[model samples]
Target: MTLKFLVLSSLALLTNAHMAAFHKAMYCFNGTASGQVNYNNDDPVSPLWMLKKSDYWFHHVNQCDDFPPAPGDFLELPAGSSFTVEVAANRGVTSLSFNGQFATDWGDGGNHPNDYSVANLAGAPLSSSGCIGNPNMHTQNQSMAAGTAFAISYQSDISQVTMDNLAVFTVRYNTPWKRVTSYDVPKDMPACPADGCTCAWVWIPNGCGEPNIYMQGFKCMVTGATSTTPIATPKPPVWCEEDQSTCTQGAKQILIWNQAEGNNIAVSGFDLSGNPKSPAYNSKCGFQDGEGFHALVAIGNVVSDTSPQEHRMTSLVHRPLPPQRLQQLLHHPHLLPPRPHQLLDRLHQLWRHRLLHHPHHLLHHLLHHLLHHT
Candidate 1:
């Protein structure tokens, strides 16, 4: 009995150490003030997935979908308005308000037992400017924290929602920093279908620790929509930190990084300044308010394609090279001929045709030709 008790205590400690999630999310329907407040129970839904792939990495294994709420219990997204949610390391801390009181105390032996601050888990000031006190939460740099986004899929059924159709409408930069966080709803957003829409809160940290992502689902409905135009299809975001002009335009899909499968963007290198070109849910990564093809055209980048093949080809040729490749070429500019634009176009064509099997080999071949022939 003593040995078993020790093991269970250790497990509980481990779970409490790295726990953080939105307290009022649909998955926490079982949480209440008078009863068991932590709806996730002892399972602990906020553990990092590291580099390994698991169903828990995204939407916490769809536990929220399984626990469907009754009508009118859905999260309301008022178009052109904002909504707030309490984020904490444990649901119990958020539940402290049920008794008409707030959890303001900090440190190890606080009123809310076994709970840590969602923003500053150490319960003290951070010594450094980057990555904050706890490496797990990655809330160190207030101006550079990986932003969080809210995406809406018109499907009322959670299972029917996928990355392709779930379009990010608004992004809150430098978020997951405070216990109470607010997210804006796009003014031009349209109403969902009759049954309502499936929404998700997605986040990818800006490289303070292990590269893990977060996605939590919510049954949400637009309460005050003024537009009838549907959200356009979402495209995978690109690493365009060096050049905002080259960023992918229109609605963007939620980032899926460090996963074995279902990864939409693959960035394995640093930028020109030696900084990891991590794709985030902010304006630097092409996500903007009222994003759509029509919005792009209104901004004067008119996209006219006669055929589907033409459209694909146009997007490919115009797409900027991957950050790693761009960094390499920019660092070694002397190897290029007098007119580098022609060579760049050729490289884009080669990339379009999938002729470059290995990126390093392609760079080597190009450099060799430029050195010997040019």
Candidate 2:
């Protein structure tokens, strides 16, 4: 038995382990707002041609050299998964580039007091050539612990009029990113969920327009994989020992009223009042149950259509014995064994649900006022 457990544990670990990943879409020339680039090539129509990317500079000459910069200016990607970033090749995109060095201010050309590696030249653009032959300038590792940060300089080479075929994909991990553990987010794809788990449709275009251009660097990736939190149906507050403390004893009672005519599902309504009455039943009103000179409120508690059959009989025709401020309890957790109350609870539950969820019900105000006055 121990051996079996060990094997299963190993398998689970193997399945959970994952690599770094990114989602890539068409690289528009120039930033979208600046009109520096456009999407060309794929069905949505992303196109690529002989246009080598300019030097890696944003805003000012030495602007992006600073640390803790904005997202569009730089990136710090993990290497757990095999990341193969290729730039659209019109002519000069040769390889990925980058280094760990960064600057917060674009010092003018030649202004370093230390003068360690230079005499002058402050705003000189850094290159991602830590190694060479790559333009996205990158680092490779298995994990990216929290708080780890890196800086890299990169650019796309527009040296030649290369083909326009869209980039390709290769798996780097053993388990699937979306299905196995985390949810997969595609760069060029948008997904719409519907009908509470009944069904989902994925919009995927099998092809891109420019079959030759390659995209550079990290893609706007999806963060977490938690889809939706499951909610279990709440059970009715039964007449259990735990609830005895909350209920009033001896001739005191709570009145729950059911209004839904059928099992049919509709919208919702507003009815916070269930039992409204004497001060004893409601401490705020100076009412005490069974002991003091307290009276019960007129409760409008919603009972469902599928209430337990045993409770229905008591609910429809419950008669209490007269007590001298002593022991005639009305609404107790202990359900009457012989009452026919099935279909009552579910009906009430549905009505309340509709009232809250579909609050724009045309007859909400009308129905609420009518029921309240009655």
Candidate 3:
């Protein structure tokens, strides 16, 4: 019994040593891990190490696009809803089920036996004291973890998609941390083309590991969309971690860091807080949820289906009242808009102004409101 135990322990150590530390999107359409046997085979879905501005930068040499899903096998993104994706060190740990077919299960490859445990699921393994020990996962301090984002291109054909049109509609902070993660879709996102939209999940870890990034493609379609206002052109994100006023205002593109070519933003030094600056997917990187809606409204790109109340609010922001008229309304509350909903609309107008001009103040007010209301 003693000899057998020693042999098993030796084998486990050897296996772990041979395994590479990397992760990929498992459930993404045409994911490379469809039928992979080695749960730790990070080759097919390997991270882009010091990538250049070539085809490889786009969905890893376009291999992910090679295995297109069958008709109707798309990653569904319901408008005003959220979708979950399974991310793992390898596909073997996942169900390997896609397009109404089940692939071979080569076991969990002993890489993540504790992943499903209650403690692990609840993030017990992640420590706020520092980065998680596993280089494959994200840091425990969510604010410190490099963020991840989901960008969508209106083009249904993956080949037709380009960086300029791939607008990032949503961002997830402290991501690549768990096997199962969820991302919120914008309520006002426009519907995709008939063949469905081409989406990509991109990520870049803050630190405590390699400087590589991840980009996986997916065939997705949005349902229940009531808006036809197309997404605005995406510009490269800038490092506005210090002064949010400098942050990009409209739709933003994904970050391409540490690459030889096509690197949009660079943070080679520390930030105002004296921490290493890393462009992420959160507010620091100019990616605020629902910013698309606000941008469109601010630019007078209001959709036709917007509610009457919303239209009134948009008009109020664009068409400011004279000082005397404003003072008259302010002094005589009775002269203001009637109905409780109109009052709420006025408050929303104020909120929108605060959000665009004084976001920090708006955040403080939001926290205060949540504390008192909830």
Candidate 4:
């Protein structure tokens, strides 16, 4: 039993050691130049390793060279993921052309950098020479060596990658100065999100034609898998033609109204034809849910119907009628035919007053006045 236990323990140790060696941890560039050119650090250097990168830059110049983990270093990229790298350091005006090195050597190679895609590495591990042959890799020439920022980017035709793997890259200043960053790119793409998660047509408040209102960078690029869900644009309220047939003599006012699909719709009325036959009355009003909407429009004092057969009467309904106008209306009642309901209501109101208390006397006087005039 002891012999069996020893054999199992040996197998387990061998397996762990083999797995550790399987990654074959890669090395960063060691600056060996004399007098302030060398960076002293052990393998897998601190703070500056790349894990997952959506977009990244290494700002070594301008005192931005502090060691910090790369932002977005841990990423679960969908298929067809891509990235760009930028260098802002001055490497001098020499015309020598050199490619930024990105390497596939997890740990096996010297200070050489790797530019190969994680997909390619998963398919077949890249040699140092293979890393150099990448088509989308960036090359630095004398023109770009003057400390101006320059960038290079690459995309992989290969769709997928295996997880738990490392991608390493480095840029050289003088003497192949290597402070490289490494990333752990993800294998599987994230699941597509639930629907209705995005704004289909973002309602820009009054954003129709004004150039001042515009979409932010994030909103502009968004597109749904299906055509963007269409939003029901709020419709403007509309005014319908008012009924003119109901206009009659002695009617003090009429109501004007409009219909709208939206809650905020407002309504107004205008006198399009100023002709006396049609007359003019303007109105303004708003709407609410249960209370209903209406606008009061004062009837015109003077009425001239388009047809000659209709009786013509003028009303002074906008304000209190002048004494002279009232006298004229009272003496010539034929001009303003009294509506039965309005006249009866007026009589009832007058009966309540002390001045014309007796309905019998009022009726007798009105009859004599009408008959004598006729």
User: RMSDs, each prediction?
Assistant: 12.2, 26.6, 8.9, 32.8
Scored by TM-score, the top model is 3
Candidates in order have lDDT scores of 0.58, 0.21, 0.58, 0.21
- Residues 70-178 of candidate 4 have per-residue lDDT tens digits of 2322122222222222111111101110122222222212223343242333333332323211111111211211111101111111112111110111111211112
> Distance (Å) between predicted and true CA of 44, model 4?
65
TM-score of each: 0.63, 0.14, 0.65, 0.15
Off-target runs (Cα >4 Å) in candidate 1 are 1-25, 31-64, 95-102, 105-130, 134-136, 289-374
Please write out the lDDT profile of model 3 over residues 1-374, one tens digit for every residue.
67445434433432212111122322233345666433323333456666665644455554655655567777777787888765544443444432212112112123333333323433324323344543245454434556677888899877787888887877777665555567788778888888889888788776555566677677788888988778888788898877898887777788888776778888768866676776677777777743445442224445666689766655554455555555454444444443333444443555554422566644554444445444
Off by over 4 Å in 4: 1-312, 322-355, 361-374
lDDT of 1 by residue, 125-164 (tens): 3424344543234654466566777778889888788777
Which TM-score value belongs to model 3?
0.65
Residue pairs in collision within model 3:
none
Quote the positional error of residue 2 for candidate 1 in Å: 23
Error of 1 at 324 (Å): 46
Model 4 TM: 0.15
